[model samples]
Target: MSKIESIFKSCLEPKEVYKGGKNIPASNKKLYKLSSNENPLGASPKAVAAIKKAAENIDLYPDQTDIRLREALVQDFDGQLAADQFICGNSGSELIDMLLRAFINENDEVIYSNPCFLPYSVFSRWYGAKLIDIPLTNPNYHLDTEGILNAITDKTKIIFLTSPNNPTGTYIPRSVLDDFLSRIPKNVIVVFDEVYRHFADAEDYITALPYVKAGHNIIAINSFSKTYGLAGQRIGYCYTTSTIANYIRQIHKPFLLPITSIEAAIGALNDKGFVEETVKTVKEGRAYLSSEFDKLGITYWPTQGNFFIVDPPLPEIEFANKLMEQGIMVRPVSQFGAPGKVRITVGNQEANHALIQALEKIKPD
Candidate 1:
């Protein structure tokens, strides 16, 4: 066996995958899938058209530079940022891996919130960094910023902060973020994963871009997957100072993004109407879900993202299994460090209705 294989021996294992509403097996009737937080309204017509047009160009390699897509992003953001500030990847996961490789050195410390996105810790471990986790406060599931700052030492190289955090929809308030940044050592690189930024409602919510502009050692990672309904296309980008962006590009594999994905992303960026429609639909569905949960007497977090976390009356794994038996597939939070809680994605009105109906049946009266 190779050294790499030996290193990964214990980590290599297949896990069960669940899709919220994909448990119906294969009946002719369509299943309402609320499992993954995919946009149920589907991709924008403009993006579809762009993909179709780009299909003719499959014979050629994509522009390694991805200039047109970067330009569109620059224009969409009103020229506040330049193309040089962006680095496109196959998905947000790939971007995460790239950042880990670019910044982390052997045994360097990487700090992130527990019950957060598992990939941040996974990548940190893969790159030989010490993964430091700060658990959230109970009940509210808010980040422990002071604990995070106190955990930092000279070996700390990267800190991952996710707003509207995964598994739990709670977000770090802007004031909290400002205070945390002020206390952390300047040498540590911070990654603000704002993949769910569009769903936030707090008036004080702000992207870390301003901090980057102010010359802080930070990177803002965003994805078209959640809001743009392009998760299948696997497109995401990171914005940072030109210096860090150049470093990431140097370490990134050339031509990793295909032509079709680039065109699709560009098309999605231009489809402001579709983006607005998605946001509206999600907001409405989220409100509807909240109301339904309230009426059902089930407890859930107040979400600012496409998904919400609920502490069901039953054990989370058992509750999820029961829902799956009824052809509903919600994600259990055990791996995300919150046992007895399940994370559910908000879908279209019909899908949300289906989920509510399923819960009503399985939940205690």
Candidate 2:
């Protein structure tokens, strides 16, 4: 047998995987990239300075335990959680994978929303878990809590909840989440991916931290990649009760988070002004994009995240290609099970204006 066939016969083809964005080649001219929902403001000055200062220590391995960063996060969360409650990872995606491996057994069922983050399904399948996908509600793209609850079975081991869900930008309301949690069996672990929590504007939307604090089987995941503009730094963390947190840490490889990333995150945490400024920019950009969509007669869901999903009149793939020709990049949601929808990252004022201008030229009257 060929080497590939002998090593892993059950593996699927690479083409079957849904990659996030098209890679744009570097050119002499700068490109305004809005394909990924990254912080347009870039890293905080404090974080940048910290990273530079930490460069001299590159010869040494990162603090194997990442205690200082964990302490900083504890302080940042305002003592809502203890230091032992957190586990740092290379990125939010890595933390997601760790949580899956740590909690899920082979062939166990994993439940999540359709048109949610694509990785949840991919990672669950990687661990040989049966995937249960629930479709979002019509028009609003909100989670179907009742449907999700009904899909649960004794075999179910995990439920992935993404507030301000990817591509859809819809959040689970507090009442809906509470009801869902109450209905779920205690044996199953619920992961609340709050990577975009900083952008949420609604008062009634809840973070899963409270559930974790109450000693529920819930883990709250957050990333510096979005709000803190530390996407390139590759640092994210999870917060849960000490019991589950310790279990996750046991499986996590030591020193996964680099010393530089840890220091940068610490500095970023201290720069509250920068975080507030990023929120303001994203909020303003979201509002502007929404108003423009209204004027263009395009359907879109109001979002509390750094991005919004738009139902362009054309097929999403074709729309995205057309936008690309105009030097604009947007996320096509076909892979996430919403083929007609396009998820546009809210950019700075200039990038937003460019996107609107390009849309005006191609959008059907």
Candidate 3:
């Protein structure tokens, strides 16, 4: 008899594409961590202060309901969403798992694209849901909405969409999203993971909130990890219809969000200046990196998020290894199902300069 669950053999662990400079030695040259798509400026100063104060009350359990943070989101959305319609989790990743646990039935199907977030397939299989993967549109790497619409079956329970898609840094346009939604059966839940939304400045990009308000089975998951630079604190939330939110909240365990994490998220939400500055830095850094890539004759996708997928002259792993030897951390996209491309996160000026220098030095002859 098998000792563990029979399903364990079919489930694959998520690939660690980025390790946040863990590979660098202590005595090595100062590491310029540009692997994970994090805010180069670090967490908001106000968030740091709030976390320091909240640390004093470590003995107290967090309010699992996440009332304050939900209210903050509602206010941020200009009251279009209610507190009851928002649910907070340790991270957007946790929320993904919760949605699958609360809604996906055995053998039900979940559809997403290749080169998308790793957690979607991981959690879907963990819950015994069948996964259907669609390829991104060629050259642009946008979600193939027509392919997705064609893939849906009566057994399909969830459709996972990632805007500013990880590794590719591309997004589905508003027209595509609208048309796709119009065709999908209302019974299927659509989850738009927009953790990188704040950094997106694409002209045709639109959020899924309108569909949510119109009573569509849509949920938008966002995180403090990207925009607010609170990745280490692990706070993220989702916006959806109240009924769905209630279901997710019920599935959520009590006190999943720690006191310090919530406090830091709340402070980050309220800090407008810090957010604006972070956005500015990312926008500028993205442009600078793109230009540098051009000067070095490297091809890269035009990104709407804080990272780019560059095609270096050498294999991605080979290029990434060269950079790592120079104390630079970057992510290779082989495990993300996009071989020959390396994902480069935009960093502050010094880090960017270091990366550019490394790339130029290692340019294939």
Candidate 4:
């Protein structure tokens, strides 16, 4: 065997990488991509302008402290959080890895949801942590906090809770969250993923940032990609206690963030008008899609996020294939453990209308 292979035969790394939605290439016609849940209105004008301006300074390294981005984030929250409480990453996925690196040890137990954020399982196992996946209740797919609490043991180290959870598009209500937090064991750290926060419109929807401000052992992950339409620039961050933030800082090399990316994020935060418009656009698209689905007799869970899951009239593969044939793209949810259904992102008026037309054509006779 090769030296590297022999030295790491027992490593927890998987041979296959994550497989999710993608934008299909080589179509002769125009494509309305509803695959990845990217911002439909496009990147914020301010962020785009920032990227252009910062591109001139590409030779310089990023500010290791990321003070500007963190400061903007603090102001974004109306100064409820200190800049020290923030830790930046290439994306929220990296923050998850940082948590695993800082805390998870071999045989240490980690709890997350089934149909969970796909990365939760990958990162947990990569750190040699024991997996305790709690299944969200069927149909609605809401978090079963009691089931999660019941699964806790002395070995448990982390629990990931994705509000406005992807693929499923549901959230833990405020009452449920309050009760769960009160009963959570002191030893277990909670990872609250909220990258889709800006798109959530349900009345009961709330951010877990308040808990972080109160010094709870929670890390709330969010991103510029979803809200500001800078997905290609790749910026993400989290809110946590200052102590945890410092530990992450120790293990993380801050210079890895690109200078252009930092400037773009800061610019995005300044454009409150753009964020408001993006939210308004997504809200309208989601309502249009939901109404169309109802008319077509489709079965779908009510969603608080920018996307929703749909049980199409045809088989998963066949249905997805048909959609593609009509110059549209969507993701199959079988990989998320929600087989026989597909997750669709809310698009702009033009894209949403195209998708409904395609669905209407593919509907059963």
Candidate 5:
């Protein structure tokens, strides 16, 4: 190891990075990119217009005092929570990092479901937190409530609950989450990553934002990347108690969101028609793909989000590579710790049709 390497913690000297859904080396225009759960309809037209309008103001610094983005979110939520309770970050992913920075100390226990958003593990390691990753229950892959309740200790600080979980795409039912929340000690703050809330159509689903208002130690994070199709804009925010929100704001630097990103997200909130259409498209595409997979005798878990896990004809890595070669891109979830599974984002009709066609060609006789 070189002198620079010598200064790093030896056990974690070479950090494993989080990989996003991306195309292959030669994949730009050729591949149907369905790996990232982005809105296939693209960013809301209203958001695009807002971004164009905001681009002229790039010379000035972003607002730190009166954030129109957070102000706008009040109307978006139908006045469920006050503007003071919401805080914005560059993306929902960044809020996790901010949470860790504000609350975590050395050896503080950070607990989350195993095979969750990859960053939960990565950020915990970076913050020197004692990781307590509990495995999800078998079959449906929902949160293992008892396992997590058992794992808690006095050192436990944060619990990450990713509803419509990444890779598995399962969620915590309302009753199950209520019971779990009631049982958890008040000192431990539970973070709900509900970025994909728009796509979850399950009857039992409920957003945990109300719990924050009710004085529960909970935080709910939302993103504009999925249903709003503002992934390129990279804007997200969280709902927490005004007290916790204040602390996060203090820890976070000034002008966290770019002017264009803020304007785009604000516009996205007003684009109700666009959001409804995106959700409609994803629901249709999801049903279409599921029915096709059934006909091909492929095994996959039912998903509430815009993506689901698919077991292909070959091992996951090889299967993912094969799809890439055939002008498609899907994520292999080995990094998310499920070895045999591949994740496919529900795409537009054209893209979804192409994926099924590709799978048909590769299906074992």
Candidate 6:
């Protein structure tokens, strides 16, 4: 065996790299991608302008502190959260890794919903931490609060909760969250990811940011990607207690997000009008897709997120391939442990129509 291979034989097991919805490479066909849950409206106009303006200064490094982004976030929170409580990262995924690095010790336990966020398991195992995955409750595919509570042990260090959880598109209600938080063990910290918050329209859906302000042992991470249409910019921030924020700051890479990204985020924040329009478009698209699924007799969970998990009328892979053949792209969720299921991101009016048309053609009668 080679020296490097021998040295790392027992380390870093092989795992499938995450592949969100992507465009097919052929230059000829017109493609409508509803695979990745990217904002179909694209980036905010103001943000695009800001990036153009900042392009001239690409040679210089960004402000490592990210004071402007943090300050904007604080104002956006309406004074409920202070700037000191924020920790910016390349994306919410990076923040997850930082948490694993800063907190998880050998054999330490981490808990999260099964088939929720894939990276939670990946990062936990990378840190040599024990991962306890609790399956979502049936019928709604919501968080299994009791199962999570029961699974907790002395070694448990973190519990990851993704609001309007990915793939499943279900969210934990406020009452459930309150109960879960009250009973959570003192040794554990809950990491709440609210990347899709803006798309959630359910009345009972509550953000965990308030808990952070109340000084709970929770960190709420949000991104400009979904709501602000800045996914390509790779900007996300978290709200936590000052103590945890300090630790995250220590571990967060220096100048992690570039100046251009920060400027774009700042501009996105300024364009509240654009944010509202994007949310409205997504809400309408979600309704349209859900109604179409119902008419087609596809079994799908009600979603507060901008995506839907549907049991396609055919085998998952075959169904996804059919969609791709029609020049439409979507996610097959078998890798997320849900065989025979696929997740579709709500796109713009035209893309939504294209997706529905594609499904109608392929779905078994």
**Cand. 1 TM to true fold:** 0.93
TM-score of each: 0.93, 0.96, 0.95, 0.97, 0.96, 0.96
User: What are the per-model numbers of colliding residue pairs?
Assistant: 2, 0, 0, 0, 0, 0
Candidate 1 Cα outliers beyond 4 Å, as residue runs = 1-25
In candidate 2, stretches whose alpha carbon ends up further than 4 angstroms from where it belongs are 1-4, 7-15
Write one digit per residue (lDDT tens) for candidate 3, span 1-365. Answer: 36675546444444333323244458637888888888899999999999999999999887766888889988889899899999999898888888898888778999989787777887788877888999787877878888999999999999999887898999888998888899999899999998998888988988878889998899999999988999899889999999988877777787778999989999998899999999999999998988888888989999988999888788777888899888788888766768778888899999999999888888977
Write model 6 residue lDDT over 1-365, tens digit each, in one string: 78777767342667645555566576688887778788889999999999999999999988877778999988888888888899888888888888888899889999988777788887788888887989887767878899999999999999999888988988889999999999998769999988999988888899988788787899987888888888888888888999889877877677778989999999999999998999899899988988998898988988888889988888888998999899888899877757778998899999999998898898886
How many times do residue backbones clash in model 3?
0
Give residue 293's lDDT in candidate 6 (0 to 100). 86
Q: Model 6, stretches more than 4 Å misplaced?
A: 9-11
| lDDT tens per residue, model 4, 1-365 | 78887766253655424675785698578998898999999999999999999999998877877788889999998998899999888888888898899999889999988786788887778888888989899878989988999999999999999889988999988889888888988767999999998888778787888787777888899888888998898889998999878877888775868998899999999999999999999999888989999998989988888888988889989999899999889898877768898888898999999999999999997
**lDDT per prediction?**
0.84, 0.87, 0.86, 0.87, 0.87, 0.86
In model 2, where is the ten-residue run with the lowest total lDDT?
A: 9-18
Candidate 2 residue-wise lDDT at 328 = 88
Tell me the TM-score of model 3. 0.95
Positional deviation of 187 in candidate 4, in angstroms? 2.0
**For model 2, how does the per-residue alpha-carbon lDDT over 263-333 read when each residue is reduced to its tens digit?**
99999999999999999999999889899989989888889899988888898889988888788888888
- Taking every candidate in turn, the Cα RMSD to the unseen true structure, in Å, is 2.7, 1.6, 2.2, 1.4, 1.7, 1.4
Task: List candidate 3 stretches off by more than 4 Å.
Answer: 1-25
Indicate whether candidate 1 or candidate 3 has the larger lDDT: 3
Over 84-171, each residue of candidate 5 has an lDDT whose tens digit, in order, gives 9998898888988889888888889999886778988887778788889898887679788999999999999999998888988899
What's model 5's TM-score? 0.96
